[model samples]
Target: MKKIIVLCVAALSLPIAIAQEKITLTQAECRQMALAHSEDLQKADNAVMQAELDKDIAFAAYLPKLDATATGTYMFPDMDMMGAKLQMRGMYLAGISLTQPIYAGGQIRAGNRLSEIGKDCALENQRKARMQVIADADNAYWTYIAVLWKVRMLESYKAQMDTLFRQTESGVSAGMATENDLLRITAKKSEIHYQLQKAENGANLCRLALCNVLGCDLDTSIEPTDTVIKVSLPAELDTDISMRPELRLLHKQVEAAEQQVKMSRAEVLPTIGLSAGYMYFGNIKMKSEVGGQSFTQKIEDGNALVSVLVNIPLFHWGEGTQKIKKARLDLQNAQLDLQKNTR
Candidate 1:
């Protein structure tokens, strides 16, 4: 009685121990799951975000920057000398500075253009990754379907073979069919049984691979609810390669390289900017130990000033020219890559 009870308990627990979600999926669902779980797709999304930040940074170069600073000092001794008392013990200093770029010899504009192109490239790459993932999932899904259907059809054929073998056995006994016929039937059944086993094994492996692609555990069994049907191909198809993402990315690369060349050329030209600042410092009378002016003041209280700045590049040891040449070469390479990929 105890053995019987234990057997019953084990049988009941078997399913519970290895149970998983019995998900039924169609081709679209499988592709969606793969895209949702793919690490490569997630990284492509991250690249787009980073490219947006790069564009923001490039645009910020033309905006003015305002800065403010303050400082405090403390001393043990406070000195009062002459009519002016040096407030050196408790001193405070503060200033504000502003900088605006009036001209950058086309460098800023070229950088901004390059950043825009880079953003587009990232977006196109993201789209390409999504398409690739979907296509891969679709292939795996359909392959699983074909293998499962093959296994099912072979199983039915085996059953028919079994029926034929039984009828032949009786025929041989009745002197209607030869023993050789029965033997051949038996051999054919064995061959089919072997083939059926191979097909079933292939089906199981296909199921596991599809489950992994769809973000399910390897142990989980997948049930595909979709079936393949015959479809007529279009009479004419467009094989144009202009819509490919790879070619688009290469084109963007060429445009960005052209901008880089412009920036490099700008490096040898003159740059102009505007600067304005306001500074203030507390006046303190020197102690008796130090005898001189009662207070330390330069520029008569250090008035505010605004000035225009210019930086002229006189010469470099062929550095700027070499960089421009290199940028042009990069552009040529990008164009060639686009043509190659199109081919």
Candidate 2:
């Protein structure tokens, strides 16, 4: 009798033993996995980098620019001077110039403002992505916990029915219970066994779905260590959408468009720049030949010059005004969208 009971207990433990092979994860661990694998977060990160680069590029417009040029020439035939060759076979010339914008008609400032707006938009988008991924992870995690608990509940119920079936079978042999009671208990045990099977399948499906969210293999199994239960709310939920990232992104876009309009208007205004340049020309050469004997000339000359430059837009057939108009229209559209999203 003891051996028979041992066999029955072993049979009942087989499914539990199999379940032990699955990995166990907590709710926080699941969220971490989801965030690590989220494609939306990856895209948001790229956008953030692009926005930062744009800001740097715009800032560069306010900085000084320096350029240098060098040229060298070799002559196949030497020039003759007073029947004596100049002996200038090769010559190198180099010039370096620096230009700093004293005024860009407010375009540089407006462009910088636009870059700042772009970065704000990108950050808001990243926040939106993170929020969405975290919410999904939370839902998936709770679902896993709920299904796991349901399976556990069904397994416990099955164990109770197993015990009752044994007691009823013994009573039937002692003539203390009817055959109908034994059959009924046996039927209930079978019913609980089937219910546990269904519950376990459900739990496993939820586990697979959670794995999919974490970007893991669908066939991989997991046992959630969290519990799901309804919680009483302390207060009513707020319906305000002002803090939403989509609305913030739209508002930032409107600000950027307004800056673009400022830049366009500035296009018709004059720009002032300061420039400094250094030029050097000449090469090792000989002085004009005298009595057929020449002296080493060492003729190299360099000069530094600074100048102020002004650029005024003379005529563009209303191009600047057209651009400003377009920018204003875009700003208006963005504002309208923001209002709609807010509602």
Candidate 3:
């Protein structure tokens, strides 16, 4: 009696455990969780940050630069003269220098423009990432729902067959129905069982795919709520490709190339700069007398200088000319690509 009671308890616990393992999710919750945990989205966010840093680096050229220097030197005379032995003397110097860019052949301005364009490109990339995530979520949600429906339908069919099987078994024993009827119902039940298994397997695969996207463990249960909102499609799309990010990025590239050409051409122009510095030197003693050493007074000096420079590119083995041609070609290619994509 004890053994029979233990077996019954174990059998009852197994069904309860299985029943407790079911997962339920709503659609909106699934999408939110996926977006929050997606590795691709995280990487896209990092890329945006990197691009912003690059923009900052590019704009740094517009700011003035300050540098400080300190040097100590010990000098030794090459030879003795006038019966005085050559000796080493120590010298210390410190200075601060400032450089402001008065002009730079338009290179700094071009760099700033390119940085802005790059930021726009990064934003477009982020948009693309978001679109991909939403699309993937939609597909996964629909597939899961479809599988659940299929499983329910199959189980309903299985229940009907179970009743028929019992009826046919009783009929055969009473000689009212042939064994063939019972065999047919059993065969149909087996087929339905196989289909149910396949459907269940497919549902599990869909669940795993969703888990991968959400960066969750395979065993984690996700229940999605339905979000099948309907929206009308646009009557027409614009023929011009400029609205697309790929085209926009290409246009920016062309503009950047044109700027580069202009910068290179401006290289032949003159550049002007203004610089200023102040220096202070400590006193140096010449000799030690009875009362005190003869010392030179400390010297403070300030200087301001203005300079203009011109660099004439007389010849560089055709490097500059080649670069200009390349820039023009790139602009043409970008335009063609935009046209192609639009079509």
Candidate 1 lDDT (Cα, 0 to 1): 0.86
Tell me model 3's lDDT, rounded to 2 decimals: 0.73
Best-matching candidate per TM-score: 1
Residue pairs clashing in model 2 are none
TM-score of every candidate relative to the true structure? 0.83, 0.74, 0.77
Q: What TM-score would candidate 2 get against the native?
A: 0.74
Which wins on TM-score, candidate 1 or candidate 3?
A: 1
lDDT of each: 0.86, 0.86, 0.73
How much is the lDDT of residue 103 in candidate 3? 82
Mind giving the per-residue lDDT tens digits that candidate 1 earns over 94-203?
88999999989999999999899989999999999999989889888999999999999999999999999999999999999999999999999999999999999999
Backbone clash numbers for all candidates listed? 5, 0, 9
By lDDT, the better pick of 1 and 2 is 1
For model 2, how does the per-residue alpha-carbon lDDT over 204-263 read when each residue is reduced to its tens digit?
A: 788777888898777667777666555888698888878989878788888887898898
Which candidate tops lDDT? 1
